[model samples]
Target chain A: MEKKVILDGNAVAASVKESLKERINLLAQEGITPCLATILVGDDPSSETYVRMKGNACEKLGIISKRIHLPKETTTEELLETITELNEDEKVHGILLQHPVPEQIDERKAFETIAIEKDVDGVTSLGYGQTAFGFGVYPSCTPAAILEIMDFYNIDASGKHAVVVGRSPILGKPVSALLLNRNATVTTCHSYTSNLEQFVKQADIVVAAVGKPNFIQGEWIKEGAVVLDAGYNKGNIGDADYESCAEKASAITPVPGGVGPVTISMLLKHTVISAESYMSKKSATL
Target chain B: MEKKVILDGNAVAASVKESLKERINLLAQEGITPCLATILVGDDPSSETYVRMKGNACEKLGIISKRIHLPKETTTEELLETITELNEDEKVHGILLQHPVPEQIDERKAFETIAIEKDVDGVTSLGYGQTAFGFGVYPSCTPAAILEIMDFYNIDASGKHAVVVGRSPILGKPVSALLLNRNATVTTCHSYTSNLEQFVKQADIVVAAVGKPNFIQGEWIKEGAVVLDAGYNKGNIGDADYESCAEKASAITPVPGGVGPVTISMLLKHTVISAESYMSKKSATL
Candidate 1:
């Protein structure tokens, strides 16, 4: 028997934005406008386009968007100072720094500049540790979104073996930590990992985030395993070879339409949550 | 075919302490007094003994040991304030709070209070994250000691499967993360883990840290797996059945002789390192 299903990224993201309208309205009534500050440096055409899309999404959701654009020649100190200013801004509820800044600037410093409270993108190790240790805090948006999608699909992770390829601080590492928090035994594989196929074959759930175009072969996948390919490579190529893997996998998320849309939606949701947390604190004090 | 080699914890610790004295002398010539602060609450005889032993170790190594004794009635707020003060004090380099504080106090709060820079014990998430992410920072004493022991034995961990039993934040969690950083494929098992025997059976290296007596059975170990037991339970029992496993394993650390002495040695080493870092910073500014 053959099965067919279509995934729509934009429509799913739009639905999430619509769902948050009421919460945004409630906070607006309380005079607390949730604000997100996006810092973009050295306009890579792709980064510029992505930031613009996010800014547009924020507008549709009634979240105040504060856009900061720095030139390519901006020094690391200058970028850090700007981020520090945003961190101190009580009006700002969330901070997002569009990644892949100029090679000269320290990207990690820029990401860490977003205070733990305002780290809507949740790029800081502080944010990661909180989630990894099972403390109550925001997770990195993409990882949280991946979990949200899994939960939405009713995938049970309890006692499952999860193999996460790539251990980038943002997505793969935190996601593996999250899966561990949910009682799934997790193994993180990187370039140093020995026998990648052996580890991948043992996974009940496979999250491929290596960004190498179709690096995960279909033969390595265990039949009926859940596959999440978060890699958005050239021409929308994913980390997994979808054609062969999809045939054997019980459930799988397609590249462009799968994790990408959920990630954006999660970022929007974080802005609203940050605003609510700010409001709750204000009310508690009052 | 019999080896008559037995290790002594205190003597091994003394040897490490003596080796560190040269570094301590170099720092001293630069006007650095390596300081280690030991905070003990209540009068648990065992804790008192341990703290005193640390202080003595520091003294022998030309390090300054500051012992802070708080009453059992100390509030969590009081303890937190004390730790915060130590964190800010330029003179104080490393902070070690004796664990298992009074029942009324929050242990997590106590751990979190230690400044990331001053947390030589590596109990805080900041320390754990830095260690996991491969940053140059102090790891929890026991785990660091385990590494030191392994290195001393000249064991190559590259491409090896290292299975770590137990998932305590201090010893087990940090050790697995450390092993992973060393290019060992790591599997972290805890109370909730199922088929743990299977994971243990497949390891090139096995670390038993569950703190339960003989939690690891001898037959499950691969014939030539390197065994590192960090368990210190009642009656000098380790998680692994030492006699049975030792005969089968290529290299094994006996219960009392294995990891215990190295742990104390590493703690003192961190104290000296913390002090040296502070001293250099002060000298640079001066």
Candidate 2:
């Protein structure tokens, strides 16, 4: 009759962080501290806050955060050179370049410069291809975190129809691949989609990443379907009309605290996992 | 009005080959003889024949196909080293490892060892990722060939519902991305799909790559939907029930002379294109 449950991404993120204490200590014992090198090109306020939060999260988990802040006038070649240095650093397990780099610098080129081994953010196409092919080292954080939340709720995606709105290389597309890997029938929609409502109504699970405030009408969701809102539009609004979706959805994720916290936590998780992978690969070669 | 157009892939392949003569000659003048290194790991008769056909096609197109055959007992490392050799070779512009490497060989590992620049077959994750992200230097041959056929027929896919069955990295997956890039709203279905008929019935375009003969029935297709059957099962059958589908489809491709010729032709086209790209990149760096 009413919304059955609200997915609390903050609580989930905390629980994940709580479980990482022992693993972090183990890495320290092996004389290999997990380090994440973050490159922030410009000082956009919101991006600054996001990077700060990531750094704080790493601090809490006993992981080292290496911050490299560059000026707005940074060029593509310089950023590429910095990324190359990080890629070749044995101590650096993961590389994160704050998105929306300066206008002069090519963002896609910068994303690709992050080596496959240290691509914890899953920004590279090679990383995505690995995910699609079913054996990726680390999937892009947001989508992978969404899956974690879904698993916490014991939602089995096998044979379910999942409609994912948005097709950004990092978010919508990779999430669709994750759902498919779980044997869910996945449909990808974009701005050009026709009769989007029809597809949404037939879906058993819905993931909205359209980046438009309240773009998905709550009434369009099939009753009792599981819904995930990955949108963070202006004024903290999400893609789904939360009030409307909460009335019908069996489970719904609230904006702000819903996806952001889980995603950031997954970023930390991926960094630690990347550190482990590097250790194993190094040991194998030795 | 039964099967108004057969969508003859063989004729299109021939036309494409004819158009490449001048370009091939122009490249020859630059001292760049478009070379494709074909690596066949075992002596499977069918695979050998396939490789031979590809070589014969290369000869006709003024492209040199260097054939490399290894014993069935070859290890994964051996194959990887061979691929690395081709990757670094200045004269080798493209690398094609015929599928179904011996059971002992790690086919995917060998595929990934291919350099992104030399991955003309588009078999690597990097290539697939590039395709999924909208602009790829080289698309996987079969799916890219399908796009060529659709263009030959002047089919505009913008804002259309394109339902693709199968999720193999090469055919179904990459084609779905290509259609999406062309502005088609794409839905990918697989063995785990539920209510596949519903999606197929509403599709403006349908591409079947499930690898099973007559896997898709005729009546499920919406009247006059654009259909592409990429299946080539035993007895030369396709995924679509061609006899039944031809009665209702607007355009359809036949099994033997349809996809096979176009796909093979595209392989040669890719090798030549790769050679040009190599020359340009080399010149740029020099």
Candidate 3:
């Protein structure tokens, strides 16, 4: 049996952190601190923990983090007001609204309120569009981090057939666009996709972003394909059946340590870029 | 002998125009004339003819068309100013910048200047992004027209394998997003794509947007597939090997009468939608 390669999300994320340090220092020296504000509506314990982990990551990386909690009953108008305030805040470089905002709130409408320059988490439609159109962009964090990991591993996507198994706006769709932009022949599959296994078998690169745990059967992945599992369900379950898929994959990401850590790292990375871009534009105008 | 089905772009466009007659009248009664502004940068005769044809279409549909000609030496700054002026104009419901602006001008920069609301031709990055994210959006005209044609033909995309050849931001990219939104398993291919024929043979629907004449071979198209030829090269040449592909295809769009006229019709449709939307927003505010 050939030895399979494991792509370490922690190691890759640490390296990205090292690269961002100098830029973070430069901003601090110029009396500009890159600030990211995260808004969480409703008290979902897991959402809170996720927000705290992100805040801790921000603290370690020297990026300022402001966490705001809203009541579960918060209305869309109130949330939009909060986003608008953050959009206008000169000190804030990025705005992230923790997803699954209480069922009452219109998450899309709230996302649209974030100014494009400050959409470091890349939740806004404009961010998605600009990235789709191949503009210099702050990409959605998880998908962008996947690209970063691939680049670090020297995985050139050009001419490769990449099959993305999900259509979540943040993960599957954006990842497909990024891959297509990099010259990968991309196939976007979802629940409605017939013969999902057939599509997976044909891909040189397979990105399993379908949220359902172990949804992608491991055997469907051909030998020597690069597998990226973006699903991190409760209890370490991922989109791909990791053990089975890894046997066939030349390289595959582990469930817990694969996509999560790198995703957090990209959030900070985009925030720093946003800070620099915004401050430069302000200075240029002055 | 099986009869081949040719999708008539002209008759469809006329039907679309006819359907809008009531809305056009309602807008007229409200004194809200839906207007489209066309910005031309240089004396490109082909471009002039296209603009004139679109203008004539608007005249037939009761939509106002403003054609603004700028000298070849028009600076990006000057064009931006013109776009800004149009963005603020109460009367201009849509703005279309005929593509391929002079070499000296930055076309993307000029496109970003169009307000998202008035981007009926959907050239703005924001417009593209909004459409990709499944928002109520004014989509890029040509791709939207293709969707309209498909809808008119009752060609449901659900569970279909759609191969989009070409990655041009305008046609191939946007159309891929639209198809995905309709639940089609979409494969986006381009010049860098290898095994193009293999992919095409597996597709239920094939969209040829590659600029090269007869770029997609006829035999690659599977029997009973729907073909959309978006390529309109000079001398009436299109991307697909039309005769051969049509023989195998259940339905196919012809070069001159297939995708072109419907594209113009969609521009007017989007404009009317934008005009009505803007007026409603205005009324809601009042």
Best model number under lDDT? 3
lDDT (10s digit) by residue, model 1, range A1-286: 3353334445556677777898899998999888889999997999998898888878877888899999999999999999999988989999999999999999887886788888889888767766777783778877887787777667778788888888788888788778888888777777878899998888888999898999999899988788888888889898999988787677788887888988988888988998899899989999
Worst 10 residues of 3 chain A by lDDT: A1-10
**Residue pairs in steric clash, candidate 1?**
none
- Computed on C-alphas against the true complex, the DockQ of each candidate is 0.56, 0.84, 0.92
Residue-wise C-alpha lDDT for candidate 3, range B1-286, written one tens digit per residue: 4566798899889899998888999988878989999998999999889988888888888999898999999999999999999999998999999889998999999998999888888888788887888884788988998898899988999999999998887899899999999999999999899989999999999999989998888899999999999999988988998989988999999998999989999999998998999889888999
CAPRI category for model 2: high
How do the residues B1-286 of candidate 1 rate in per-residue lDDT, one tens digit apiece? 3442333445557677888898888887887788888999999988898899888877877778889999999999999999988998887889999987899999888898888889998888767776776773898988998888777767777779898887777887788778888888777777777788888898889999998998888888998888888998888889899888876688888888788888988988888888777877777998
lDDT string, candidate 2, B119-170, tens digits: 8899999999999997688899889888999999898898899999998989
Candidate 1 docking: what grade? medium
What is candidate 3's CAPRI-style docking category based on DockQ?
high
**lDDT (Cα atoms) of all candidates against the true structure:** 0.83, 0.90, 0.91
TM-score of chain B, candidates 1 onward in order: 0.93, 0.96, 0.97
Candidate 1, residue A136: how far the Cα is off, in Å? 5.1
Could you tell which candidate, 2 or 3, scores higher by DockQ? 3
